[model samples]
Target: MNFRRLLAATAASVIATTGLVACSSDSADTKDTAAAAAGETITVGTTDASKKAWAAFEEEAKKAGFDIKVTNFGDYNTPNQALEAGELDTNNFQHLKFLAEYNNGNGTDLVPIVATEIVPLALFWKDHDSIDGIEGEEIAVPNDSVNLGRAINVLSQAGLLTLKEQGLITPTQLDIDEAKSKVKITPIDAAQTPAAYGEGKPAIINNSFLDRAGIDPTTSVFQDDPASEEAEPYINAFVVRAEDADNEQLHKLAQVWHTDAVQKAVAEDSKGTSVSVERTPEELQAILERLEGQLKK
Candidate 1:
């Protein structure tokens, strides 16, 4: 469930469906708003298409004297980059593993301020219904560094392929042991996985794209258990700069997502795909540190 290995260049359309905003200008890349502005508008970046589900939370924040702006994005790459550049006040798209990978690779100190939803990355097939039916087919996997290894792990668990190094958290396409695998592996952008599925072709699709493509990710051919110990690293979170961890409005923004109303919205709206998580800062920080260490190596 640790998708810190490869994160592919998701298509621009993901944002198109999710509703994107004007690109954050370089002029306002870094924020100097260190002081808490009473009732100030707070913009939180995200890739979730159904962010309107949080309208209640936004309203609650407004009543409590803060404006909440949910900024939707397309690619997984841009949110953290934008957050690190100070374009967004915070972001809630990626899991802890993805954030740790971003921090390690990019030298950004974005920290998970609060827990959000934890979805699955399961093997999805369009033309074929089952994994066994596509034994001779070529499967598409992510080429991104953070998700590639995890994608490989999912395929390996399906008994279709073998990695050169087994049990790696961040392996790439080069790690696949072709001699021992039955299916052909094709690497492509993570965004393309859902669209790439076709007759005799398989793709290990992430839930972000699965939801966008209208596929019920919870019913994937195979997927990780959100409550399983193996999946602890994949819990999604609202991330902010280390310096802004104590910002009251940011804390309130994080608090809104954990409410029962928002939780119900995520479940009912996402069709039970987005699993809510509640982990203490100490717990998540420890996990992040461990993941960051693994990524650094």
Candidate 2:
């Protein structure tokens, strides 16, 4: 079978059989025993950059009656692939746009269960103390497609450069009119942004990577909007197989992540690097649809 058809078949199979659960006892003692017996140990895949956030998630999951095991992946692409292959039960490292792009491009059926945090891109410099002082230097940005475009958008938002009329969706270096800035623009891997900043060039680092690299957002020279309408599409979420959307356990897991305690912990631990946002599933669906449309264009 062709790859797209194969993915559709796999997604259908996963959706069809994920709902079956064995009946067990309901008494308090038996319930404890049964819950323990049913205490499924499911693996969740996420980027190493999200370790602190996921640690908060793990604590919250324990309170919500789940024994979730989190496995850290070094990069963004592997987690969903792990989920699709049954190596992981779920993942929570990506925003709606990233997930939609992955599914469309690879023919996967991964789906989101809940919104989690907003990891905004921040512009930082080694020599400069503020955005106004960043002129006449080289700026390092993520060389990858998703982040390279995002870096340009963040730079444009800061009035550091001007983009073509096509807007920020998929901007490139050519889209930038370099004559406007005395600085040179260079693209580097997202992971290397912090080191690049330390070496005297300004870099646009994704929030999670910045957190992992121990850079405080409060000290960043310039930051992307955390609550802007433009950033709504980049809100991170808990993702599962399309078939697992209705699973009671996963629904409960989503509740744990959205609680007051989890939100507070994320805000504190992320040190403003990640912001928690609450939204109805219907609202999130609409936002995801809009982001997906932008990515496709």
Candidate 3:
């Protein structure tokens, strides 16, 4: 696979429907202890870079008798399919909206076991230094329907435009109330948003392209609040099959990723652009259900 293309896909690509093969848990173990304490091997999947950041965490899990084997994938589509097919114990790579979209689009019920950080989405002026410097001019955003809606929300929150209250989980550019907006929204491929933003053209960029574009999150003219109510749907998460919801070893794996060490590694890997957050599994499930409803509508 071309690394660059896969990298870009990893950030914003919608996965096509694929056959999922669910795997069976080993029922043959005679150990009376909890599954995690029984020296179980938990397989996980995520983007390529996650494995490196998780290497020490994996080792730590092993010390606690839960051996975690994290596999790497290049694009956003495969991991979840693998998980559904029972190839992986769990995976961490998408926000709630993406996961919900996956379930709705494919009729799968992959569920989040824990919450993770909200990746920052921001608007940067190519020439202007701040939001005030931007006029009611043409602005570029990710054209993908899901991310486009996100860009619209970020822009709306920045007081750049007004967005119609759509019942959809993720809004498209059509949801933008153009009559109440200041700038012309230009939707393009997500890979192009960084360069467009770079030229001082008003551009809303996704976090996936940040490092590749060498754009620092702190330097943006208008950045979304990770802690804000509007951002809750976008918070990333660790997901597993619904069947594994009560699996002791899988829960332990989620705990391993939620630890300070794993968080530190995430910050380091993301260059402090993203931070880890812990949300109640119930809350995450609600968000997923709500998003799923919107998609079905």
After superposing candidate 2 on the true structure, give the runs of residues whose Cα lies further than 4 Å from its correct spot: 1-38, 49-52, 127-129, 179-184, 207-214
Off by over 4 Å in 1: 1-38, 63-66, 72-78, 81-88, 127-136, 179-182, 211-219, 246-249
Error of 2 at 112 (Å): 1.4
Please give the distance, in angstroms, between residue 173's alpha carbon in candidate 2 and its true position after superposition.
1.0
* Candidate 2 pairs with clashing backbones: 15-243
Q: List model 3 lDDT by residue over 1-297, tens digit each.
A: 221122222332222232222322333131113343443456778885453467767866776677567788988999989988777778988899899889988989898887768778888775556888575779998988878877888887888877778433567777788898888888899999888877768888876788788887677888778888778778888898775554454566677776777778777777787867788877888888888887788
- Cα lDDT tens digits, model 2, 1-297, are 222222233332321453222322232233233333343575778885354556777887887667878888888899999888777767888888788789778987677778887877888876566888676767899999888877787888888877656455668888888877456679988889899977877888876577678777777788779687767767888887765554445656776877776677677766756777777656776776666677777
Encode model 1's per-residue lDDT on 17-96: one tens digit a residue. Answer: 21112222331122213223443456778886456556756766666666667777888989988787767778888888
Quantify all predictions' global Cα lDDT against the true fold: 0.69, 0.71, 0.73
Q: After superposition, how far is residue 260 of candidate 2 from its true place, in Å?
A: 4.2
Best prediction by TM-score: 3
Worst 10 residues of 2 by lDDT: 1-10
Better of 1 and 3 by lDDT: 3
